[model samples]
Target: MNKKLCLGAFMRPISLHTAWWRHPNAAPQANFDFPIIKDLVRKLEDACFDAVFLADHLAVMNMPTNALKRSGTITSFEPLTLLSALAACTTNIGLIATGTTSYEEPYLTARRFASLDHLSSGRAGWNIVTTVNTEAAYNFGLESARLHAERYERAGEFFKVVTGLWDGWADDALLMDKESGIFFDPEKIKPLNHKGKYFSVKGPLNIARPVQGWPVIALAGASDAARQMAAESADLVFGNARTIETARSFYKDVKTRAIAAGRNPDHLKILPANQVYVAATREEAYRKKQVMDDLVHVDSNLPNLSLKLGVDVSGFDLDKPLPDIPETEQSKGHQREWIALAQREGLTVRELAKRAAGSGIGEMIGTPSEVADQMEEWLLTEACDGFMMVFHSAPDGYDDFTSMVVPELQRRGLFRTRYEGGTLRDTIGLPRPDSRVD
Candidate 1:
């Protein structure tokens, strides 16, 4: 069989580009518009994308008040609710919603995903997150955010309990025998009498077994603990890297860890986030990038950069090189990446902050064919299994990628031209998990 790349569309209510909403053709307030989201989901499905990954946050990410007011960053619909609505309008495209283990109960999380699996006929996926924003703690009535290590520890137990609940009823437990008047085989149902450091539950999941046994688990984190969790439990891993060398290292590390954890490394797909600007020519694409880049305000984004770097770069000269600062305990992965990027590119505080506001992943600026060439190189070089595309603007950017890039990828035999399976797992070539109760 020929090697094919997996593609996922990273969907957000607002544009990832800081100033994208100000673009002339941008749809204002489209995040809350259900009709627009429905159309976008359909477009991705028609393009034969494997999944539409929905990113979520419990609170607005604005730290500096000025940035919050200046940027279009405040509004968003809850992810699960949005995914449920989109599921009704489309089929075959996996609906992956962000659900943080930090703020939710295992039983509710398990039940919600199980229900989504049945509703989508096994196209549901959960993007497990630990909710890193400190502002989110205030919203949840906590004085301070939980320590990073503690959060992951709870997440470990949380994953165990949720999967245990999912296995409560065997796949063959449902009988539906009308003549005998037996709806299910009682012997096939078992309770999860789980007691752990974080959660304790006795459950036989109320819903029937998911069509794919359990919805796919997607994880995104770059720390050692995060990578270990992905190796042990996740079916798909989302990552970010600014260079191919870094991405290749991450790819090898993840696969090696998966092997050490007693799993077939091929079963775990590592997809780094990728941003592209495609037009008829390379000049046009560069012009488009410059247009968006010009709209970013330095003062408004300094706090965000500071947060990522764990130091105040705001006081530094805009044209001067960044001073060496200690790494943040908050997001060490991001700190390391930003520092490396600054050193490699010789970027100043202003230039680095502006770049950060666009896409954390590096950009590909070229025509459809050129962009496709880069994607294929990464896949063939083992830098990544695929990409989680971060669009500059939805619908329009999405349309451009599907119309221009998708066909080019198909021409090169690097992407799927049609749906290959009924469920997300089938399209991605992941095996359907067997029910533990059986």
Candidate 2:
């Protein structure tokens, strides 16, 4: 085990808070503004963070039409374009951007990440998402979303092809030997004629092998399919967890599964999502949260939650009991996570509704000392290897976190004092994977 904590942000522009744009201090137009991302990356690098990760999907989040009309986080710049700009500004922190195997062709995805890996000198990682939104299928010209089971099946095949493509050329294949006059070595080059249910690709990828062999693969933890993917393939699994017990369970589950799948358990690092609302005092933090909550528009959020949760929550009284929630024994992990939070706190439907709209995860509101206490418990107890930070506002939220929370973590010996290495792989302690041809 590397025995290190990897801290990264679950970065979204402006804030997911609906009224964040209207906040006097919020940068409403920052999502499209280049300097916004540039400055954010510099702050993370300066804070000695490991990476800044952006989650993505191929199409709009399938909010019910009314919800779509009312949302602020409805649209933004493409993550790849944004990450590329981030790469130009920072020298050390990793840049991870989500791309799905469900919709994208493996060779193209491979080539794009390989290019990013090269451009960043191996500081790029792909957050592999088997996109969950069915609306994405229609937008991409498909008739409908692939079946839930089918997406994961295709994803397994997709990883094989991507890794196989990366192995197509041995490092020695580029024999720039002057005297031999043979600028290339045919024997060292390979072609992956991968045939699978979802893809059939032949030959080497257009680009050379990435500096990291395969750029680091990070997975979003949710389904059984996602767990299997992490066990067999991913180097990092971002668990959407709300508590220590759940994160610890997930950490053990993935590590055990990886070993059973013939991989080193340490290869899978468990990271849980955490939201922060920090202030000078605990009361001030609560005040900040209440202010942020006042800004959220319930009407704008209801339909969006309805579609994703597969619960038509529109007609129910906000204060009433949940009804007509679909019956599925299968684990809708995030849905369950929300329920767990409500049940544990004995919260009402209305109260859960309010917190749910503020940010993607449950909130950790307090002074830096209080926040640091929770974080220390999570890491030291082995509940998570690290955290995926969700900020309340763009630059201001991030600036507050770095200035206030980060120093506390550093003092606790939970995060870095200075960046340890140049490339993302180095920070993660992953030696460059040797080309399979070699």
Candidate 3:
């Protein structure tokens, strides 16, 4: 069978741009408005997007005090709560919410997703994250962030426990025998006496098996430890690649790891985050991107970038190349990618900062056909299985893709014109996992 492209909408209340809310067409208050979110999901569903991925942070993104206030990164609805509301309004589009293993308990996470899966009629997905922000530690009563290695270790065990809890009941456990007054088969239910290095979860999950067996597990981590976790568990891998070569490398590496883990590589879909600006003409699209680019306050972003990279680039001259600094322990994956990007392009501080301020991933600035062509090229080259599109503006950016690029991809038979199945797993071509209770 030919591979059809899998598209997911990477949604935040605001765009990747710091000044996105200040855009003339942007709705600055959309983050607090459910009606607007509802509209966005409806449009994505209409566009035949496979899922709407909602990224969450337990605390405001740690940035300079002024920058935090200037940026819209701080304020947003809780992901699970928002997704639950969205599930009530949409029929087929998958609702993927980020849940962190670092801060949340396995049993609670399991229950929330199970309920979401049932609420969305099996269209739910969980984007497992080991929350990265150090400030979040304080909120959870810790003084500092967990070590990266330890976090991923906890995450691996967390995944095991959650999936085990999801498998608490066999698919046939719920008989609902009305005449006999038997609610379920006790023999078919099992408790997960999961004791691991990081967690001890004893359960028969309160909820029955999710409609799709387990809600689809979506993971994003670029580290070796992260890759191994994805290989062992993830159905979808949200990748970060700035170029096709890099993307292909990541795709091959993860698939190889999956095979080594005794799983079929085809079951793991690699979807890189794609930033696109589409217009009627290529010139128009570039103009649209420039408008957002012009709004960027480079100085405001420097402190944040410095903190992220683990070396202060703020003192360096804007036109000078980055000084060789050791990678930070904060985010090894991002540190490696940012440095590679700078070295590859010989970018100056100003140029790199500008790039950081904009969407920091594979980007396409083109007309509808041009964008479609690029997407097709990437898919055919095996650079990625699909794309998780991050729009420049909400509703408007989303409107443009669905109106322009979606049709072009459909015309080329690279994307679906309608949803293929009821559950997200089915729509994404993943098999329903058998219950692991036995």
Candidate 4:
């Protein structure tokens, strides 16, 4: 009875799996692996996915460079660069990439996406991120990291400016009027002249309004301020929460705010992160996934857990109770959502983390039917518009699901059989915006 939601993959350019290089079938040698990704895009197209989303960070992770490299998830290619290749390879599936608001000026960021939109014939989405790494601060010439709240504030303003700039050039502004010797209608162009708290920019973008009126703006936010930005400005919001109840709460929270802000509640689509695994039987899938989970450093993960929880988990026994760590203004907004799920489900902190991790894929894992049923239930209850599929391991991790599960989804009639049209907006069923100057 509900509009079956769409699907998007959350990916890195090269690797997403730590043991991917060792996956026997994994492609370890080709980090440039554009062909491998082309196959991936084709697979998504086969399954009628709306888009394939790419995530990025601006620096080498602070961990030992070799260790990070061993993880095979070290910085790969720049997202837009790789996605451009994807645009050439696949026809219908949307291409989404992460470009940070913290480190980039809006003009360049806006132009790159607009260009990709054109290249993809409008099949493009932009994942807006205000990154969390400290290393990026130094690389970008800042002496210190801005506080998380401050970063979000800056990010919010940047979104406004970029969207504003996208509108500065009117639909008819660029005409090759050789007879009149005018390349553009100067009257149709306006300078942004924006002087915001964080950024000052001027003038119309060199690129015209993209095919989608602009590429779809996706917000991957888990913090409260971050969620507000998504609700206010995002066409799609990506979240990595662990349970349906938690997902529902988040979905409702955003919709409520969007309504108060005079935006359509339906305009804000909530997509919780779901990591998935599938097989002929649930038990075999479970066993295989546990093996992959074991390769993860259980001990090393505690520190990251601690940082998110705002409590040191180093001393806490995996068998003991998780200490109460009050949520802070600048951190752990996702954990706040996690804690709510734990309380609702009567789960221990360790249990919660394990479920998150053990889902073998973050928040979504199971046999094909089980995973599909859960997804449908979430949709029926209004918990999410769809999932941003985060592959736990690269290549084969996604390959396995596409091979095993996507067809099952097709049989169920919950997903599309083919892409409806060109352009990411058309693929996602969003109407293209009319060219505007206001």
Per-model TM against the reference: 0.97, 0.94, 0.97, 0.90
Sorted on lDDT, best first, the list reads: 3, 1, 2, 4
Question: What is the lDDT, from 0 to 100, of the residue 304 in candidate 1?
Answer: 65
User: lDDT of each structure?
Assistant: 0.86, 0.77, 0.87, 0.74
Report the number of clashing residue pairs per model.
0, 0, 0, 2
Off by over 4 Å in 2: 1-3, 64-66, 178-180, 327-331
Kindly report which residue pairs in candidate 4 clash with one another. Answer: 17-393, 122-423
Instruction: Write model 4 residue lDDT over 252-333, tens digit each, in one string.
Output: 8988888888888877677787777777788877776777667654443544455456555556656555556676533456
lDDT of 1 by residue, 1-438 (tens): 377899999888456777777777878677788988788888889999999998898887746777777666588788888888888889789999998898899999999999999989889999998876777888998866788899899999999999888888888998999999999999999999998788889988899888888799999888899999999999999988878999999999999999999999989999998888999999998888888777777656687687677677778888888888875547767788888999999999888887777756667889998999899989999999999988887666787789999999999999999997799999999988888886
Poorest 10 consecutive residues of model 4 by lDDT? 355-364
- lDDT: the better of candidates 3 and 4: 3
Minimal lDDT window, size 10, model 1 = 325-334
Local accuracy of candidate 3 as per-residue lDDT tens digits, 1-438: 287899998886446666777778888887778898899889989998999999887887677677777786767889999999999999999999999999999999999999999999999999999886888999999999898888988988898899889988998998899999999989899989988787888898999899999899999978888888998899999987888999999999999999999999889999998989999888999999899888877556686567547677767888899778785557777778888998999999888887888767779989898998899989999899999988888767888889999999998999998887789998999989998765
RMSD of 3: 1.4
Score candidate 4 by lDDT.
0.74
lDDT of 2 by residue, 91-159 (tens): 888989898877899988999899998888888899887776767788788886677787788888888
Task: Give the higher-lDDT candidate: 2 or 4.
Answer: 2
TM-score of 1: 0.97
User: Highest lDDT, which number?
Assistant: 3
Clashing pairs in 3: none
If ranked by TM-score, best first, what sequence of candidates would result? 3, 1, 2, 4
